[model samples]
Target chain A: MPVEDLYPSRNRTEPAILDRQDPIIHSTDFSAAPISEEQLRQYEEKGFLLLPEVFSRAEVSRFLNELNQMQQDQALLDSEVSITEPDSGALRSVFQIHHHNDLFSQVASDPRVADIARFILDDDLYIHQSRLNFKPGFNGREFYWHSDFETWHVEDGMPRMRALSASILLTDNSDFNGSLMVMPGSHRKYVSCAGETPDDYYRHSLQQQTVGTPDNHSLSYLHKQYGLESTAAPAGSVLLFDCNLMHGSNGNITPMPRSNLFFVYNAASNRCVAPFCNQPPRPEFLATRETFDILPQRSASQDRKAG
Target chain B: MPVEDLYPSRNRTEPAILDRQDPIIHSTDFSAAPISEEQLRQYEEKGFLLLPEVFSRAEVSRFLNELNQMQQDQALLDSEVSITEPDSGALRSVFQIHHHNDLFSQVASDPRVADIARFILDDDLYIHQSRLNFKPGFNGREFYWHSDFETWHVEDGMPRMRALSASILLTDNSDFNGSLMVMPGSHRKYVSCAGETPDDYYRHSLQQQTVGTPDNHSLSYLHKQYGLESTAAPAGSVLLFDCNLMHGSNGNITPMPRSNLFFVYNAASNRCVAPFCNQPPRPEFLATRETFDILPQRSASQDRKAG
Candidate 1:
C-alpha cells in the first residue's frame, strides 16, 4: 500500500490540544489501543522494533528539505560545518537548527510516538531531546558498531528506569544509505568496551590513553552470535528500540543524503538530566499547553466504565 | 627558590619511561614511598588527595610547550579551533592529537604516578585514556560538578574494579586560577541525568548536558550541603581521586594559563575494549625487562621480610 494511505489525513488534526481546564491525568492507561504486548516483548528480547509508515514520504521529504536548508545557512555562519576530514567523514554542525523548527516539535510530542514509549516504559513520558542526524552522501563516514546506551551510561551511571528510543527516518533508508543496525536483546547484557580498567578500554588515537572508545567488535560479535535483525525500513518509518541495544551503522554508501530525526523520551517519574548540550528546556517550550496536557487522561467515567 | 631548584638534577635522567615486563608494578612503586595509610584513608573520605612536587618544573614546562605548539599546528590544518565571541579570551579546539606525540604514552605509564594509582586501587593497574586540559587566563569556562565514574558506569555498566583518576597540574593552582573543586564522598551516591534514559541516549544533544553549570544555584546549595572542598595545589602537584567523586573547576580567571594532564587508570585484570580510534599499544611500549625484574624482586623481598 502507498505510505500516504496509511496516515490519517492532515485535516484530521491531532487530538485537539488539551487545556488547563481539562482535568490532567498523570497515570498511563496502556489498555487503550496501543502498541501490542507482543511488540513490546519483541523489543525487550531483540532490543529494537520497527514501526513502518510512521511518516509519509511527503513528510519525510519536507523534513529533509528543511534540514538541508538549515545546514546551508549554518555553513555560512560557522566554518566548523565545512571542516570535514576524509577520515571522520562529515563534521556537520548538530544541535543548531532543529530545536527551533515546528516539524521537530510536532514529531517530538506526537501522541502516536508517545504511545509506543508509554507502552515500553509502562509509564507517563517526556520528550528529553530531539536530534537531526544529517549524513550527506558526499562526506558520510561509516559509523562504528556500538550501543547508544553505552555512550549515555558513560556520562551517567547505570539507571534502572526503563527507557525507549524512536528514530524517525526523514529520508529513504536502506543498507546502502546507512540504515541503523541493531543487535537484539544486547541491552540486557550491559558491558563496557573494556573491563572496568582504563587500560582495557580503547582510546581514540587522539584521545589521552586513559580514555577508551566503545567496543565495536564486541557489538558486532554479539549481533552475529544472537542472529540480531537489522531493520531496513523505508522513509517515514520509525524504529523503536531498547536504549541498551547494541546498534550502529556504516556510512551512507548511496549517492544521496541520509537524514533522520531522533526523538528520545523517558518515563515522567524518571529523573531527567539534560544530556549533551548544557542548555535547559527553553522557557517557552516548557510553557506550551501541549507539554502539560498531552499525558494520558484517566477520567472517572472512563476509569469506571472501563473497569 | 626558583621552580628549577625544587627537584634533584638526576630526576630528568629517567625521562619517565614505562617498564614493559611488569609495567603495572614498576609504575605504581615510584611514589609509593610517600603514600601513607592515613593518606589513603583520607583519599577515600575526601575523594581526592593532592601530591605536591610530583613533577619537576622542567617536566611540566616541557609538556606545556609541546601542547601549545601542537594546538597551533592543528589550527592551521583544521579550522575547528576558535576564539570565543566578544572577547577572544578562550581558545577552544576538539582536536585529537594522541597519535602524533609520545607524551601521553609516557604519562600513562609513568612509574611515580602509577604507584599511587596501584596503592589506592589495591591492585595492578592499566592506563585508560588521557587528555591535556589547558585553561588560559580568564579563557576557560567554569566546569560543572559531576563524577567521572557516574558517566563511565553508564557506558560500561560493569562491576567496579578499582577505578581511579589523577590530575597532574603543570602550573600553579589557586582559587583564581582554574583549580579543581570537589565534593568529598559524593561518589557514594549516584544521581541520574536526562541522558541516562536508554532511548535517545545517542542523540547528540543528550551528550551536551553538563552536570551542573557554575550559574546553577542548586549546585552551589548542594555543594555546601555536601561539605565540598575546593582544592588549590602548587605546580607539579597531583590529585588522585575516586572516579565516582563529584568534581569540577571554575574558569581560569588569573592572567596565566593553567595546564593539567588527566590520567585515568583501572585495575590490570580488567578487560578493555578498543577506543573509536584504532590506536593500540605499539609492540615496543607493551612490556619491558625492567618491569619484570622489579615486580618479582619486590614481591620476593616482601615475602621474605614483612614490613
Candidate 2:
C-alpha cells in the first residue's frame, strides 16, 4: 500500500519527516516510513511509537463535524452519553462508537490500523475492544498510570501480551490537554500494578475495562528506572503502544479539548482463556472473541460521500 | 434442599414466606408460589413480576459487608472503583465485582437468578451480564426512563428479546431512595421510542450504553398506554423484567440508599450478529458473548469462609 501521500498536505506534505527536536513525539511508522525492521526496533526501545498525520486535515475536519453533530443531537444528550463530572454532568468518555456510527466503524477497522496491528501481532487479528476518549478542556479527567494488559490478562481472559492499542488523536493533542503519557521501556516487565479487579463493576459497568495501575511505591521504583514521556502530537497522529506499557493522562486544565479513538487489536490465536477465574471476561464489544483477517484498505478519507 | 428453614432464626429459617400486605411488593413466585403457567401469563400481562427474598438476611448481611468494604477500600478506590461525580468524586457505581470479589461471582450466578431465566428465556442459557447498581441516598443519581433491550438490539447485536434481567435488591428499596420504576406491559410492543442511535456518545462516553429515552410526544403516548409503577420492595427482593420493558428510576434524595445486583440472562439460541452496522456492541463485561449453561444453585450465601 502506498504509505505517504506524495502530493503532501499543507501540514505534512513530505510524510514521515521527523523534526528530531520538534518537542512533538511523532512516530517513525507513517505512510512513508511503513513497518520496517528499524521501526520495530525503535518501538521495542521506546515501548510506544507515534505516527504523525495519519489523516489529512480535510479528513480530520470531517470527523470533527460528525462528532459535533452527534454530541449536540439533543436526543442523544438525554439518553446514551454519560458524564465524567457528575456535578457539572459534562461528557467524558464514550464506548462502541464504531457500532453506532458507520464512519467510526470504518475508521476503527481501517486498513492503516489493521496494517500496523499485523506488523506487531504478525497474524490474523480482530478488534478486541474499541472506545473514543475525550479530555475536555478545564473539566477533563485524569487517567492514573497503569498498564492496559494487566487487566486484560487477569479479567478479559487475554492469555498473553500479544495485543496492543492504537490511540488516534482526532484533535491536536497539546501538552495542556490531557495527552497520553507513558513510561518508556516499562513494558519489559509485567508489572502487577493492578491490585485487584473489582469484579463487581465488570457486570455493572464498563469502567473496569482499563486495568488498575501500580501503587506509588512501585510506580516510583519504575519511574526511577524508566523516565516518562508525554505524547504531544498534532491532529491525526496515531500512537501505538504495547498493551503492557505503563501509561496515563492528566486532566485537561486548559481551553484546548483533546479527543482520540482507541482500537485494541489481538492476534486471532490469542482469544480469551478464562480458565479457572469465576469472573467472566469482558463482553464482545470490549473484548471481541472472533477474529477476522486484516481488511484491504479502502480510501477512507476519500469516501467523501459517506462522510 | 429444604425449601424453607422450618426452624426460624434471626434471618430466614424458611426459604420464603408471605406476609401478604407487607407494604413491600412480594412476588407470587415465592416459596408458596413457583414459576408456573399462571405466573408466566401474569408476566406476559404485566411485563414484569416480583420475586421476594431471593437471599436470606444473613446472606444479604455478608454481601452488604463486602460492598461496604469495597466502597471504603482505599486500594480499591484508587485502582478498581469508578466514581460518577468528578469533583466531589463520590462512589456512584461499581463494575466487575464478580471478577474481583468471589462473593459477588456466586451471587451473580445465583440459582434464583437462573430459575427466573428458565421461565423467560425458555431454553439453555448463559449470563449476558452482571452488575451492582447503587442508588446512594442524597447523592444517588437518576436513571432516566429507557429500555435495556433497545440498546442491546441496536448496539450489542442481540437478535431477539429472549433476554431478561433480575434486579436483586441488596437493600430495602424505599420511596425516598431511587427504586426501579416501570411502565407495565410496555414489552408487548417494541416502542421504537428510541430514534436513530446517536452514535457520537458511543465513543465520547458511556451514555450510549442505555439508548436515550423517546421525545416528549412518544413518551406521553407510552405513559398514557402504560402508567408507571415504582418497585418499592424489601431487601433480597428480585424484580424481573422483559428486555424491552421501559424502566428507569428517579434520583435518591432520601437518607435511605438503594442497591441491587442485576444479572442478565439470554437463551443460547440467540447471539449477536454484528453484520454491516458500523457501531460495535458493548464490551465483554457489559455484554458477554460466550454461552454457559446454568450453574447448579448452591446456597450463594452459604460460601462462608470466602465471604
Candidate 3:
C-alpha cells in the first residue's frame, strides 16, 4: 500500500502534533531550563551543535580503559570481523564494548546529555540505541556524508520531532583527526541518498568502497548551497544534530586512535523496529521504569565488585 | 572489538551449521527433497518448518481485500508496500499483510514459505516477521497473543530464538470482533494476581491495557516465565512459536472479519540482538545477481518516461 493511505488523513500542512515546541537553550555552562530559542534556531539553520565539556575526563578515560580490556578479552576468544562478501554498500566495524556496559548506561542517563536531547527533540527523550565508534589508528574507513534521519527514514519515517543523535568525542578531534564535517541547513532539505545512482566518485569505487565513502561533489554542492560547516571539538565535547541533518566524518588520519560514543534518542512514543531477534523491546524502549529497576545501577560499591 | 566480546564466554563448541547434505528447497512449487532427516528432527523438536509457496488466488484476495481502496491504489504507486513509521508498532500491523499477498515480490520470489528458512535455520519453523501481518481492516486493530523464545548460546553470545508468531487470517480483524488471545504462558504459576496485570482471556477491551493493569497478570507472568504462544490458523496458515515452546492463543471468538495467509521462517543468523544498521557483509550473506539489476531496471524505466 502507498505509505500515505496507511495513515489517516489530516492536515498534512500543519506540522504533526507530535512535533514538540522549540527547546529553551541554556547558557554555555550547559545549565539552563532547556534549549533556548537561539540554540534551536541555530540548530535548524546549521544542522548541528557542539555542547562543550559534556563528559568528564575521568569518565572518558574509564570508558576507554573498559573498552581496551574488552578488546583483549575478545581477541582471546578468537573473534574476527568480516565485511559483507558480495557488498551491499554498507559499512562495518566492531567495538570491544557492548551496548549493555555500565558506562553506556551512565551515558544514556546523563542529565546533561539528556537535557541537550530534550532541547533538540523538544520532548522527553528515550534512548534508541548506543554504540562506541572505534577507528583504530590504521583503519582507512571514512563515514559517508549523509543525514542520520535519511537513513532512519528508510527504517523509521519523516519529520520526527523526537529523534536526534549525540556524538561525544572521546579524543580531541580536528581536520587531521577526522572530526565530523556537516552540510549546514542541508538537514532542512531532508534528502534521501540511499539507493540513488551514485555519481562518478561513488560508481568508480563500487567494488571496493562501502556505504560511508565520501562523495565530494555531493558534499561540496551541499556546502556551497547551504553554507555547510565542519565540527572540531575537544575530547569531552558532545555534538547534537537532528537525525535528518546531513553529516559524516573523514577517515582517521591522526596517529592516535579516534573514538566517539554515539547515543541515539527518540521521543517516548516512537515505536521501535523489532531488532534482528524476536520482538525484544528497543534498547531505549526497554528503559521503562519497570525495566530500569532490573538494570544494575552504578553504585559506589560497583568498583569493589569489579575488583 | 570482535562480536564475541559482546557476550560472556561459554564452553567451546563447534558452530551450529546447517547440514550440507540436505536437499535445497526452492520457492517455486514448495517442492524440495523430502524434509531431510536432520530437518525433520529440528522441526519436530523446534515446532516449525520453512516451506516456500507459490502465490495462489486465496492468498492474494485475502490480503488485497483487507486494504482500503486508497491503500490499494497506493500499492500501484510502487509495486511494494512502504512502511514509513518504523517506531510505531502499528505500521507492522498495516504492512505485514503484503507478505501474505501472492502478488507481492517477496512472496513471489520464494514460495516455499517456511521450508528454506527452516533448512538454513535448522530449527522448527516459526514466522519471525511475516511481512503480511500488517494489513488493517476498515476499523483497524487485529490479533493479540502471548509468546516467548527458546534460548541458546552461540559463539556470538546467548542467542534467544524462542518464540515465533503467525498471521493465519488475512481478512479484516476488528477490535469489536474477537482477536487472538494468549494466556501469557504459565500465568497460573504466579501466586498473586496483582493490579494492572494482563488477563489470560482474550478480550478486545483489554487490548490497550498496560503492564500493571489487573488484566495484565497473564502477560506479566508469561513475560516472567518467558513463554507465550498463539495457535490461530486458517486455510493458508502462519504460526510462530518460541524456541522454549510456551505459548497459546485465544480462539477467534469475534465475528467482525478474518482471513489467513501464513509465513514461517527462522532466524538466518544466530545473534539475538538488533542487527547492526551497517553490519559488514559476510560471505554467507545471500544476494542473487538479480538483486543489483532490480534497481537499475527501475532507474531505466524512470529515464524512459522522462525522455
Candidate 4:
C-alpha cells in the first residue's frame, strides 16, 4: 500500500481544514516522563506547554554570551546559516546551532530539555532543526500566522505530526514585545494552506514568508474558535508546542528585544523522505534529514537533578 | 556486491599517497561531445582545460550587474550564503547561486558549459555545488592548498572521483591578481591529508580551512613533480578542473578585484551517502546530495549556438 499522507498541504487552489489523524502524544506510558500529569493535560488540551524558569539565569546568561560571541564573529555572521533582518540588517536567526557551536549542542542535550522532548515524542528523538532567533528592539519584523507543519511537510517531506518545537527564552518575553503567539488547541486540526510551494521557498521565507501561508479566512476561523495567546515569560522559560499548532508573532515595537534558542525535535522513526509537494527537500539546516538519538542510553531521570 | 570504498582518506592516523583508481572520462561515446578532440586529450593529460572567451563580454557584464545587485541588497548580503572576507567583511562568496538566482541557473544549464561537463563525465549530471567566489582587491584572503575530493569524500560522502568544477571568470584575472592556481597533471594522485575532519568544518573552513589540508611535504612533492600553473585570462573565460586536482590561490594584493561564478558538476550515480569520516554530512549548499539528470533530452550540440 502507498504510504498514507496523513496531512496533505500546499500546492492547492483553496485552503483546507482537516482533522488531525495522528495522536497528539504517541507515548502510551509516562512512567519516566519529565513533565507533570497536569502539564501533559494542559499540553494535550491547548497544544502547548510552558515551563517557567526551567533554566537558571546563569545558564541563560551563558547562552547569551555564546550568542553574542557568534554575532560578533563576522566570519560566522557572514555564513549562509546566519540570517539578518531585511531592513536594519540586525541578526535575526542563526541556524544549526547544535552542530555549529559546542555550547548550544550541550544546551540541546541537557536532560532538563531533552527529557521533556523524549516524553512528548515517545520515541528516540533527533534534532530536525535547531536555531537561535533574535528580535532586535524596534527593528524586529513580524512573522505572519501559519502552521510550521504545512511548510515542513510540503517542502521538507516530514511524514507525520510526530514533531514538536522547544523554545528557550534568552530574554524576558513580555506582552508588548514580540513573544510567540499560538492559537489555543490549534494542533487538533491541520490547515492545508493554499498556493504551490515554489522551489527554494526557504531562501526568501527565512526572512519573510510570502508562500505556504494560512489564508485570512482560516486564520480568522482559528482565531475566533480557539482564541490567540501570546507568551509573556521571564528569561530561562521553555515553551513547547505541537508541530501543527497555529502560531505566529508580532513585530517588536518595544524598546526591549526578545531572543530564544529554538530546537525542533522529531521522532527518529518519522524522518523525512522526498518532499510531499514533489519539490527538492530543503537544506539540512532548515529541516534536518539525519536521524540519531540525541540522548543515547540515558534515562529521563538520570540527569534531572544535574541539569 | 558491497560497494568498494575507494579513495578513503580521513580517520587514518597519518597521510598516504594513492594512485588514481578511476578513469578521467566516464562517457565512452563522443559522437555528440561538445569539446574538441584536442581539448579532451589535454584534459585527460593535465586534469584541467581552460577555454578562453567562452562567454561574450556583454554576457559577463550582465552577470556582474546581477552580482552587484545581490551584494547591495543588505538582506542578501546578510544571509549565511553570502560569505565575506574575515578581516574586511567585504563580500567574498555566495553559495547556491543556481538555486538562489534564475539567471545563474540558465548559465549553468547553458549548452556551452553543461556540454563540456557532459562530454567529460560521460554521464547524466547534477549540481554538486554552486557558488560565486569574489576576491575584492586587497581584502580577499588566500585559499590554502587542498584537494576538494579529500573534503568531499570525507565530509560530504561523494562516492567516487567523477566530479569536476567549472569556474566562469567575471573579471580579468591578471598574473598579480588572485586567480586560481593548479598543479598540472596532479589529479592522478590522491593526498590523504592528516587530522580528523571536525564537525561543521565548513563553518570555519569557509573563511579559512584549518583542517583537511595537505601537509607541506605532500605539497612540495606535487609542486616538484607537476609544477604549478595559474590561470591568466580575460572576462568570459572558463576554467574546468578535476575534483582530485591539487589547487589553491594567493590572496589578492592588487587593486583589481577578482570574481567568478563557480559550479561543480558530478555524475548522478556518484551521489552522497553517509560521510566517509563518520561525521554528519555538510549542508546541501556546500556539497549537494541530490541526484537528477540535468539536460535530460537535448543533445550537447543542440544548444551550442543558442548559448
Candidate 5:
C-alpha cells in the first residue's frame, strides 16, 4: 500500500472536521494538568490545541539561562550549528540539543507533552525529530506557508499524520515578533505537496518554507478553503499542531525576539519506513528512531525532596 | 585586559603532569565500569584516554537504528545542517544534537562522562557543546589539524584550558577509516592560533578545522616534538581528549566508516565572559552557558526498577 493510502486525495472534496478532545488550557504548571476528554476533542476538531502558560516565569527564566549559556559557553560557540543569518549571524535553529543538555532532554520527554501525544497517537511514542526555532528580534525570518507532513512524509518516510509537533515557547511571541499562522482546519486536505533541493546552509525545506513553499495553485486553493489563524502567545505556552496542518510564520521586524523549543512525537508503529523522495532523511540529532519511556512525572513535593 | 591575561604564555616553562583518578571504564553496560586511579595517570601523561567497548552490540544496534532513522526522518535530513560534500549531499557533521534525541541525551550526560569531567576539572560541569562527526565510508573528508581552544579562547571568550571532549565511537574506527590523530600532551601550549570564516555549507571554522588548520610553523613544531597517535577502536570505544590538544583526521578513502559522538564538557565556572575575536560568538546551540545539575547516577537495578 502507498504511504498515503489512507488519506483522502488532494482532489477529494469536503475535508472532514476530524473530532478530538478540548485543549487542556493550563496555567504555569502542566505536569499537574489532568488529561481530560475535552482536550482530545480539541485535538480532533482544530487539528491543533493550545495549552497556555504551561510554565511559570521562574521556569522560563531558567530556560533562558540555559539558552543564552550555550551561546556564551566557549566550547559550544566553536561548534558548527545552524546560524540563519551569516551576516548578522544570529541563530535560526539548533538541532539535536536534547542529546547534550539535561533541560532539553527532560522537557522533550515531559509527562504533559507525552501524555498529550499518547492520547493523540494511541501508541508508544518516539521522538520523530526536534529543534529550537529562533526569531531573534529584527533578525527572525519568515517561515513560508507550508504543511510539515509534506516534508515529513516525502523526506522522513513518515507514513501518516499520526504524529504531532508541540512547541514550548521560550520567549514571548508578540504580534510584532513573528508568530505561527495556520490555516484553520487545513489538516483534512492531504496535499501531495512539492519538494526542493536542500538549502546551501541548513538543507531545510518547508514544502512551504524557503524554496518550495506553496505554489500559486496550492496557495489559492488553501486560501479559498480556510482562513489563516495566528498564534501570538506569551512565553511558556505549549502549542501543539497536527502533522498535516498548513502553517507558517511571518518575519519579526520588531525589536522583540520570539523563540520556541519544539518536540515532534511520533507513533512507534508509524516509524519511517522509507524515504518517499530520492534523497535520505536528515541527521539523527534532528530525527531519532529510538522510543524511550517518559519518566514518571515528579510532583512538586517529590521534586523538592529530590532537590 | 586581553583574554590571555589569565593564562600562562605559550612559553610557559613547565607542563604539569596533572594527575587524578583512574578511568571508570565500563563495557556495554555503563554501570559496570569501575573508576580506577590508574586511568587518571594515563590522562595526565597522554592528554587523551580510551574507554574500550563501553557499549554492547545490542546497544550499538539501537544506536544504529537511531542514526539511520535520522537520515530517513525527512524533517531532520531536510534541516539546515552542515554537510561535508554538497555534491554528494552526505551529512558531514551534525551540531547541537544534545537538544533533540533521548538516547543521545542520556548517553551525553551518562554518569560515566560527568564523573570524568568532575574529576578532571575539580568542579561542577556544564556541557560546552556536542556534535556527531560522521565519516560515512567514501564521503568522509579530512579534519585538518588544529587545537580546539584556539577557537574557543579567541572567538568564544574561553579564559583557560579547563575543558575536555569525549568521543563515543558509533562505528568501528578501523585503521582504514578516518580516525582521530592526536599529538599527546599538546594541550600545554596555549597557542594564539588563527581563525577563519565558516564554510558556505557548514557555517563553521576551528580557528583551524574549517579555516586555518595549522601553518607550517605550528605543524612542523608539533611534528618535531610529538608523534601522531590514532584512535582506531571499535564502535563502542570512547576517546576522550583535552580541548587544547592539537588534533585532526584524514579522509576515509577505504570502505570503512569512522563516525563518533563528541561531547565537550566545561567547568561551570569557566562560562564564556565575552567574545575575544572581531566577530561575535557562533549560535547558542554551539556554545551554552547554563550550568545544569547532574542527575544522580541510575544504577542497573534502579533502571530495572524504574522500568
Candidate 6:
C-alpha cells in the first residue's frame, strides 16, 4: 500500500494541525562527534542547535571566493538553477551546488558536516537538496514563515520528518543583517497550509513562495505558543534545524550582507513517494529522489578539524 | 537489497552484451483498443509497430501550432529546457512538454495514446520523460546508435525493459527526412557501451551524445544479425517500440523538416533508484525522478475518436 500522507498541507480548503508522525533520530551510532546529552536535550526542546566558529577564517575566505566567482560569471548567473532577488535583481540563491561545484560537493561529504547529520538522522542519508543563499544588503528579500516538510511532503513526496538542514554561514549574520529566526518547539506540530499549488510552481516559488507558506492564524498560534528566536552569529558557524521547524528570515536593510551554504540531508529509508497533494513532483534540484546510496562518512582528520 | 545493475552500460571498463532481463509486455488489460494477435506477433518479432495516421489532420495541425508557438517565444527558447542544434543554433529539442503545455498533458493522458501503453506494459504507468524533437531542414544533426534503455538504466536508474517510446509524428517523415531507424530484433540483446558518464553529461549528451553511443563492434554485430529498417511514415502516425531497441537516425539534409512528439512511459513498479554508474542522476527534464503518479486513462470519446 502507498504510504499515507499523515500531514497534508497544500491544495486544501482549510488548514489543520497534527502530531509529527516520525522520529527525530533513527540511529544510535555515535562513532563521530555526537552531541552531548545536554546539547541533545536542547535540540529536542528547541528544534534547532547553533554551533559557533565551526570553520576557520581561511576556509570561510575560500568559500567566499568560490561563491563570488560563481555569482560574477554571467553564464552561471543566467542558468535556471540560479534565482535572483525579485526586487533588486541581485543573486539570491543557487540550487544544487553539491552537484554543480567540486568544492561544495566536498563540503557536503565532509565528516564535520555529514557526521553530525548522520548522528541526528541516525541512518544512511542522501542529499535531498543543496543551495547557496545570498542576501544582499539594502534590497535583500525576506523569506516567509513555513515548515520545509510542509512543502516537501506536499510537492516533493518526502515521507517523514527525518531530514535536517545544515547551514554554514559564509558571512557574519548580525541582528540587523537578516539572521534566521525560528519558532521554538514548532517542529513538534505539523501545520497544514491552504491554497492549491499551481503547475510548475517551483519556477516562481523558488523566487518567492506564496502557496506553501503558513497562514496568519497558524503563524500567530505558533508565535504565541513559542516565541521566535533569532540567531546572530559570526561567519563559520553552523545552524542545524529539524525539517518541520517553522523558520524564516528578515530582509537585510543593513550594510552587512548575509550568505550561507545550506545542505539538507534526508534518511535513506525516508525516500520520497508520489506527492501527497497529488500534484506533480518538484524538480530534482529541489528534492532529490534519484539517489539512495548511504553516505559513507569521511574520516574527520582528513579535513580541517573543528575549532 | 538494492537492485543490481543488470545492464550496466556507461562508466565501465568494456562493453558486454546480456540477455534482456525483463518482460516486453507487462499487462493483459484489453479494455481499451488492444493490438490484434498478428500485430502483437509482429511487435514481438520486430520490436516495433508503426500505426498509420492514428490522429486526424486537425489534431496534427494543432500540435504543430503549439510547437511553433513554443519555438517562436524567445523567452521559452532561452530557457534551459530548450536545447539548440550545435551547428545550426536552431531549436533542436524542448523537454517536459507534458508539464509545460496544457494541450500536451491532455494528449499524454488520452486513451488513444496511453491505453496502448497500459496494455503493453500491463501495469500502471508514469511518464519517465517527454520531449519535442525538431530536425530542421538542412542542418539537423544525427543522433548516434544506442538503446534508450541503456542510457535510462545507467543514468536514470530504470531497472527493467518494461518501458516503451511513443513517437507521434508532427510532420511527414520521408526516406530522406531523418526518420528513426531501428535494428529489427535487437531489443532482445542489451548492449553495454564503453565509456564513463562524465558529471553533468546530459548538458552535452542531449545536443550531441558522444559518451554513451554503442561501439562499432556492437552496432556491426546487431546490423549483421538484424538489418536496420527506417520508419518512413506520414504525419499523425504513431511509432511504438521497446526501450532496448537499437535505434538512431541520420542527419536531415533534405529541405523538409521532421518533428515528433516523444513520450517515454515506464511501469509504476519500475520507478528509478540511484544511477547505475554511481554518478549524480541527470536533472528532471532529462530523466524524471519525481512524481510517479499513475497516468489516469482518459475516456476515449472525450477526445477525438481515433481516426
Q: What ranges in model 5 sit over 4 Å off?
A: A1-307, B1-34, B81-84, B194-212, B290-307
Candidate 3 regions off by >4 Å? A1-32, A35-37, A75-99, A156-161, A194-220, A273-307, B1-307
Error of 6 at B79 (Å): 1.2
C-alpha lDDT (0 to 100) for residue B41 of candidate 2 = 70
Best by lDDT: 6
Model 1, span A43-157: residue lDDT tens: 6567677888866667777877777776667544353213233455444334312246776766665666766666567667655445666676533544444455444433322
lDDT of each: 0.50, 0.61, 0.41, 0.80, 0.62, 0.82
**Candidates, ranked, lDDT:** 6, 4, 5, 2, 1, 3
Q: Which residue ranges in model 1 land beyond 4 Å of their true spot?
A: A1-30, A75-93, A96-98, A156-158, A195-213, A272-307, B1-307
Q: How far is A13's C-alpha from truth in model 4 (Å)?
A: 0.7
Contacts from the true interface found in each model, as a fraction, amount to 0.00, 0.00, 0.00, 0.00, 0.00, 0.00
Q: Candidate 2 vs candidate 4: which has greater lDDT? A: 4
Better of 2 and 4 by TM-score: 4
Would you estimate the TM-scores of all the predictions? 0.38, 0.43, 0.37, 0.49, 0.44, 0.49
Q: Write the per-residue lDDT of candidate 6 for residues B241-280, one digit (tens) a residue.
A: 9999988775543346899999999988889999898688
Tell me the lDDT of candidate 4.
0.80
- Sorted into a CAPRI-style docking class, model 5 comes out as incorrect
Evaluate chain B of model 1: give its TM-score.
Answer: 0.66
Off by more than 4 A, model 2: A1-33, A73-86, A203-211, A290-307, B1-307
| C-alpha positional error of residue B237 in candidate 4 after TM-score superposition, expressed in Å | 72
